[model samples]
Target: MEVIVDPINSAVETLMSGTNTLFILLGAIMVLFMHAGFAFLEVGTVRHKNQVNALVKIITDFGISTIAYFFIGYWVAYGATFFSGAAELTQNNGYDLVKFFFLLTFAAAIPAIVSGGIAERAKFNPFLIASFFIVALVYPFFEGMIWNGNFGYQAWLEATFGAAFHDFAGSIVVHAVGGWVAFAAVYLLGSRQGRFRNNKLVAFAPSNIPFLALGAWILTVGWFGFNVMSAQTIDAISGLVAVNSLMAMVGGTLVALMVGKNDPGFIHNGPLAGLVAVCAGSDIMHPIGALLTGGIAGALFVFVFTWAQNNLKSFDDVLGVWPLHGLCGLWGGLAAGIFGTTTFGGLGGVSFLAQLVGSLTGVAIATLGGFIVYGAVKQISGLRLEPEDEFQGADLAIHKIAASSMDD
Candidate 1:
């Protein structure tokens, strides 16, 4: 029988696919914009002398990340390549291409997170090289393992545990990985000059509170897209994710306000801590569960940041990425197991054992990969600015211009 294709049905399918492509493209843009937040946050935190370097590092890292992920990382993660001709690539409304764009934003965030920790003192070239390797190889390895189910890791989790590991929007995959990787780089880079003197902590006040607050606000706004758009298709979109993100954000903010005693930096970062925690389970979680998860993350950031600053004499994490992203991301992973279960008023498909194993595994891979990458780069090209150069600040030393021309 000669069958006539339905033009209306074909049109609807095209529209739907086109809509989803637009949706993810917007998500890619939003997350891409969050790099500005990362820049400003680091700019505000580091001394004014390094402000120019902060801005340059984030944008440059993003550029390098795009190149690396496009050339290599995308294939590493999903076994897909863009080497196909434009005619083939334009198929399916170019949804696959936009999907790659969306995920590349996530992969780029690793270097952005590490940039904060190593700000002011790191050599620009070596860090970029390390970031290149990380985005091209290290990050995508774990990313494929979890998100694409490569290497049978997810299968192993399901077979061994009651449920497979769950990270709806990459609490462990992105944030935690970035955080722990930052920790390794920070450790290897050592404390910034005079961050400690004779076993005494020296407080470095933020250069610009307004800029810092602006960064936080930008990140908070962009995060809704980050969480909600992980669905990647219009049909899979969930209002529940949006509401959960909102609740978790407020929960984190209030808790940070209380626990941090209204410190502006802590207050601003609170919502981020919450958002990081909630990303793992926003789809399945009750709003209240998300709130508590975020609240705990906020408090954890404040406490761990304070404790690490005071106790870890050799470890100087300038923006506290370790606590905010790494530890809180880890907590979010575990919290998914707790809050994303029927017992906790969630949809129920998470295993605490799986979470524990997966979270720690991410931490391990990121940390080890960070050390190996940074260590090799450090030995070969060196990681830090020279003492005289560091003292001169990255702005003058590397960029040869201060944040303000008047300073010249």
Candidate 2:
């Protein structure tokens, strides 16, 4: 039989693939733009003297993360190295290339999260070096296990628990891991200069509320793409994911307002906590479930942030990223199981035991990785600035420029 080549069918396939590629590319750009949000949030939260350093660190980390992820991290996570000619790479309408870009944005978030926690005092070069390793190895190992099912982890989980670990977008994989890792860095770096004086807590006010609010808004807007676009293909897209994100955002905002006593910082960060929590089960959970999960996350951020700062004298997490990303990420990871079951009006394909084990696994890896990475760097090159330099602020100490020096 002579098979006739069908041009029309081939054309349709090409169009659909092209459309999916465009969708994911846009999502990657949106997530990439959230790095600006991360920068501004740090800039606003830190003192004016550290503002310039805050902005510089995030952008610099992004550049390094791009290099690391492109050359090494991508291969580690998906077993697909980009060591081929450009023509071969562009064959699938550049779909694989764009997918790398999207996933790279996610991997880069680790340093961005760590930057906030270790703000104002870290040596820039050492932090960058640490971030390079994290992107290249630490983050990708867990990413491959959960997202790509490397090393038979997913299969083991499925066989043991009747359901594999389910992180629809990366609550445990990205946000939780980033958060916990940041905690280790913060702990190792020690409290900032004058953050605790004679056993007294010193409050360094945020430099710019408007900038912080702006950052929050930008992150909130960009998060839709982060959650919904995880579908990665047109056929898998779900409006329910979008709606769940919206509900969770609002739930978090309201709870933060109430729990934080209307504090503007908490108010701004509220939506983010919610969005972080909802990321795990946005696909399977109902909007109400997402709302509940988000509300709890917001409350946790407000309360844990306050408690951690007050009680943990050695720890000085500048933007409360530990609570927002770490603890809330754990909650989100587990919440997926509670809210994603058929009994809860969700599309069921989850196991709570699987979630607990997987979430704990992510935590263990992140904490160990963060401690090992930061500890090694600390022992070798040191993590913090000198007392005099720290007192002078990072902008002057490292960059030789203050945020504003009109008189100079």
Candidate 3:
């Protein structure tokens, strides 16, 4: 019996043939799973009464981001760039698909940021509305200018500086965006009741360690896709990216263990810190470099978390999004400039000056944009739940349901 293979169509083939698309699809799935991680992490961090609310918010934001990105965000970010038939956005090679996937991941992040701000008491409707704006309009615009081939600011940077700003995955775009927005939301929402009775900090331990651990693991796995898929090329670069990501995570874990003096919380979050730190340079860094970067990030997480809790009085980053995602993302981006290989050629290589500019630019954009949107929303609609809701819990007040059946 003779088996016949259909003629390979190049147009359709390019989309799926290379490592590009495969990496992208894998990244998308990995990032998607991070939502579960977020849910678990946030639920574990907050009071039992707010568990349902936290999970619901994460799930709803993800759903909204998927739909919004597919329809408007994707087109605006990638599809809209094509001029005539020559510039049509190709999906098979995974650029457009990657953009779509990244948008969803981006969406997951924004709500995660807000989770800390409105932890114990947030009205579901307001939260949902805020999510819509972030995913639909706000995120796409910035991402379009950065990663979208047709319209990204990277094109401008490449033309002007002779090299484009590097963000291997999204140390700046995804994580920082969420952090700044979360900062605004929390500021507007005000501190949790009795959080500071006489200008002193209070302790709010996580109720479920198992959930937090699961979430951290999920994020670790997802990060592999996040870092590797950013490299559109399928050569040694991809492998390097994966290796760097792993090394950094391992390094971060070790550092956290040493710094925390055997504390599980610090260790639990070390992998994530490592991933975030290496994200900016995953495609360029060697394995050893990745380990060093990750280790620093892990150590930083311990300090930042503690600092934020103690020193940063107004900012209630419930899951430590600002430190874990925002600060670490910035570190990764800057690190890329310092550590990026000149040997790689093209955008993967960078000078220290260029890296500094790019890192600052990312911070400026995220901070300014976040402050504006969050402030406006707060002024117009009042961004927090009623005091009554705070004492009772948002799950019951907003959703009229408990996170688990036990509450019922």
Candidate 2 residue 196 C-alpha distance from true site, Å: 1.9
Clash count of each predicted structure: 0, 0, 5
Alpha-carbon RMSD of each model: 1.4, 1.4, 4.3
lDDT of every predicted structure (CA atoms): 0.94, 0.95, 0.74
Winner on TM-score between 2 and 3 is 2
Question: What lDDT tens digits, residue by residue, belong to model 2 across residues 221-310?
Answer: 999999999999888999999999999999999999999998999999999999999999999999999999999999999999999999
lDDT of 3 by residue, 157-221 (tens): 77777778877688777776666667666666666776766789988778798888888888888
For residue 223, model 2's alpha carbon misses the true position, in angstroms, by: 0.4
The Cα RMSD of model 1 versus the native structure comes to 1.4
Cα TM-score per model: 0.98, 0.98, 0.87
Instruction: List runs of model 2 lying over 4 Å from the truth.
Output: 1-5
For candidate 1, lDDT tens digit of each residue in 188-285? 99888898887789999999999999999989999998999999999999999999999999999999999999899999999999999999999999
Over 4 Å off in model 3, which ranges? 1-23, 79-99, 149-152, 159-161, 232-237, 342-348, 405-408
